[model samples]
Target: MTTRTPDAEPLLTPAEVATMFRVDPKTVTRWAKAGKLTSIRTLGGHRRYREAEVRALLKGVPSIGGDM
Candidate 1:
């Protein structure tokens, strides 16, 4: 089994993640609800995402027919 990296930071807020992906905050929330992205909840019920996971998702998205 693979071990996790100790140097890795925790999670990012929805707003920060939205800025990273260039999408609206609600989009991040939708992704979490649909299981496309993973998030954790705070005691106040706020959502947060793992940056490494988000980066992996970004890599899988195909560019627009070479236009991107």
Candidate 2:
């Protein structure tokens, strides 16, 4: 089991976020592009979203970027 620092939050894959929002993974990607959600790029170039932000969005909270 790997340990993470307090500031190191777990990231969510686009597919994971999609499942929570009942949307397609592609839609999640689009949302990132549109700034509806904030995404972090891995060294491999894949996008990862902050889990807390995604959950907040699911709760009908405004996104940090306020684009949603």
lDDT of each: 0.77, 0.91
Candidate 2 stretches greater than 4 Å from native: 1-3
Question: Candidate 2 has what TM-score?
Answer: 0.85
Q: After superposition, how far is residue 41 of candidate 2 from its true place, in Å?
A: 0.2
Clashing pairs in 2: none
**Model 2: per-residue lDDT, tens digit, 1-68?**
55789999999999999999899999999999998899999878999999999989889987656855
TM-scores, in order shown?
A: 0.71, 0.85
Strongest candidate by lDDT = 2
lDDT of 1 by residue, 1-68 (tens): 53559996668899998898899999889888877787898778999888877776678753222211
Q: Quantify how close model 2 is to the true structure by its C-alpha RMSD in Å.
A: 2.1
